[model samples]
Target: MILRQHGPQLLHHIKILKLKKNLDEHLNNLLTSPWVPENTFQFPARGKRNLRFQSQRQTLESLSDSLDIETSSKALSFLKSTLTSEFVVSLCLLANILQSTISVYKILQSPYCDLKSAVEHTEDSVDHFGNIQRTMDVKFSKIFITAKALMSQVCEEIHFPRVAPHQHYRSNYSTKDPESYLRISVAIPIQDDLINQLKCRFSDRKDLLGTLQCFIPASTTETVDAEPLK
Candidate 1:
């Protein structure tokens, strides 16, 4: 599953490509700094969302940037189109996770990253992602609270059908409110998925990496298939 950077890459789901495109276009308008200041907010060089492992690792590294004119303008326009506090918060959260994942991913890419280092990085990433429901509650704490309040209203309205939806909401609760749309209480399948992928990809490479160690040291004998000269 782990291929070289230039090897064949899969196509990304349409949703991912759209999310990245919109995110790239509006980097200037979005306030990603309070959440993640390290990101440069540059678009991935490859247009396809299903990035190669190397590409994904790189894109995660620069998922946000300080606002520039064009990016800012696009962000502003985007904000105007979808103005909602919850939506904004979710965007901030997305950037945050991406930034954290970038650190681990870079470690995995290092030429010196041996099986030991790879396992450590993968474990750290898995810990950060938090597959346990309660831990997720902590990671997405602020958003979790907001999402809960939103979900409550949604369940009451959908099942009961007697409760009237908010009439004066600036954002539409009747259709898809961010509060209801993004559920923080449940395990985040996306984060869990990435963690699983990392484990499955790297766990089997121990023997190969160990053998490479011999080749790395200059003092080590080069393979002499034939006997040495007398």
Candidate 2:
């Protein structure tokens, strides 16, 4: 027999059977004894509770709690999953732009953050937390919103051609006005930060482009341990 033809139905039937078994076990336990303690079968009014019943109750409660926790954890995990690839690429591009606009004075200051750190470095701390603080600085404020909007526009403009002939015809025929394709050209300013990041990341690699990182910061800082003369 062809299992593929009826696999779904067979699997559902198996699940139903398993559910029925669980229900039967639970019902048998409840029906065989009393919902509350039964004094008729017992000598005392409040005799010792059935050990089997106690075990079943505990098992059911624990299983119920476990199922709840599993369901909630899965939902929370799904909700917290990263944004779309397009969105991620857009955000990365935005950071690239803002990094371009940062002043030389800002780079030498405390926290001494760099855009190369975001791209070249593979640490989560730099990506999520450090970049956020660096982006919020005054020097980066001008290009931040513009960069984001530009990225969004670029994503929206790029469209894929229809695969099926019927789909293509239907889409074209249903439209009252002719749809014209817009050419989107992005002139991403190749700033020093971008160059530095590219250079740092691809310097040792052979197959990558290696000419981007040649910009020098306007200022540098050095710490020295001074000796005190008595």
Best by TM-score: 1
Listed in order, each prediction's TM-score against the native is 0.37, 0.20
Candidate 2 TM-score over all chains jointly:
0.20
> How many clashes (backbone atoms < 3 Å, residues ≥3 apart in a chain or on different chains) does model 2 have?
2
Per-residue CA lDDT of model 1 for 4-42, tens digit only, reads 652444323443565577556544333333333653344
Worst ten in a row by lDDT for model 2 = 177-186
Error of 2 at 168 (Å): 62
lDDT of each: 0.48, 0.39
Which regions of candidate 2 deviate over 4 angstroms?
33-48, 52-230
